[model samples]
Target: MNALMLLVQKLSCDVEEHVFSEVSLAIEKPESYFEKFKERLDERGIDSPIDQLAWISLVDALLDHDLAFELDWKESGLYICDVVDELLDRKKMAYISWGDFEDEEFDELPTSQCLNEISGKLKEVGISLAYLDIDSDSYVLITVPSSDIDDIKKMAQEAGYSIQDSF
Candidate 1:
């Protein structure tokens, strides 16, 4: 078996306790809906990173089944608030896998980045990857095959996020 499987099997032997030293980490840009959306933005010269990130995340929130929105953007904007240009930093929140990028990809054509850096990293470390759903302003992590919901919940909670079951 590969190193990751071996590690999992070994660590799982105890079922109670084991000490690990360190972790190693390792994304493919998929031809997903969000990718196509990015292309559309490129074609139209939507060059602003903030705009790109926003539209990309919005498209992710809309098109990707892995990312379902509990509260529609329009409803929140029209009834509660207004759309504005706000950016967090070099990192932007994205709902689709493609929307998330590795630090290395920042220099490349924004249209070309991995599907989901987080999932890729998790899978590399023998951890199951969970899909994220947008619950209004926050995100909910839904477990996939081989995933630990509790583990995923812990990570999200640490990041100041909460979980929801509904789509």
Candidate 2:
């Protein structure tokens, strides 16, 4: 499904007006590949969504005590993992009317929707959340460049993903 792509519009300096940038994330693993990854979370006793495994992967990738400090969310009174939990809950409540979603809190969203919400929140710091498939085993995080390119690049590089200005 073309569900992994997000279209972003930009006012180009050279263009007549606007141009479209495709936010095509790269997740370089098969379904079975995640089982090993899930073990890491399981060892830590963290339960996350299955349908949106990509979302869980993002949470694992970005979860850090220093994240709130680096992102200036420390004073926002929540840890990165805490924000992630709240986001999952918000999605659950938002889709509580749907029988399928209501049946399971963690599985309340499609991957695209979850990624979109995370992207929106990241945008607050001039970063966009996405996956970049760097190898055959797992997904690596990436960002869409904005006014905060330097910080974004550092984060992506620290996460060990190649930086791309556009998809």
Candidate 3:
């Protein structure tokens, strides 16, 4: 199994939210969607960092699920509201996981225990573990406050986990 890590800032919008808001718009206007969306988000008082890969993954996932409205970008905009409503109804956050470990290696990976430990440690510092993506290879993608990133890294390191700066 391949062990990889990514240091990502948690966005205010989850997968569903991002898909409805940004992805939908981007699909309709592929040329300058991000710039426009960023401007809109700024106006709305949201300052979360946007990850292009995450958005691409969301679009792909939507397409794979046959949730994409239509091939014509112009008509695609019509489904934005519907897609947002449907995804909101599902109430699921989007996350990606990696790793292909054997049953025996499951316990050796960063299991719930390790995550709970990290969560507790972070909580003490006033940082909540909002979301997590972990795989059998001990690769972890954690979402926490950007301000607490360094602290979280230190704690993870002290707990015997190596932090990779990127994927």
lDDT of 1 by residue, 61-162 (tens): 322332222223222211111110011011122223222332343324221122133345335534333324333343323223234545444543553443
Best model per TM-score: 2
Question: Which pairs of residues clash in candidate 1, taking residues 3 or more apart in a chain or in different chains?
Answer: 97-115, 98-115
lDDT of 2 at 29: 51
1 or 3, greater by TM-score: 3
Superposed by TM-score, candidate 1 places the C-alpha of residue 103 at a distance from the truth, in angstroms, of 49
Candidate 3 C-alpha error for residue 129, in Å: 1.7
Ordered list by TM-score, greatest first: 2, 3, 1
lDDT minimum window of 10 residues, candidate 2: 16-25
Put the candidates in lDDT order, highest first: 3, 2, 1
Worst window of 10 by summed lDDT in candidate 1: 81-90
**How does candidate 3 fare on TM-score?**
0.24
lDDT of model 3, residue 16: 47
- Give per-residue CA lDDT, model 2, range 21-139, as digits (tens): 11112144524435556575575454543444443443343332111111221112122224433433432312112222223432454444444555565566554444443332332
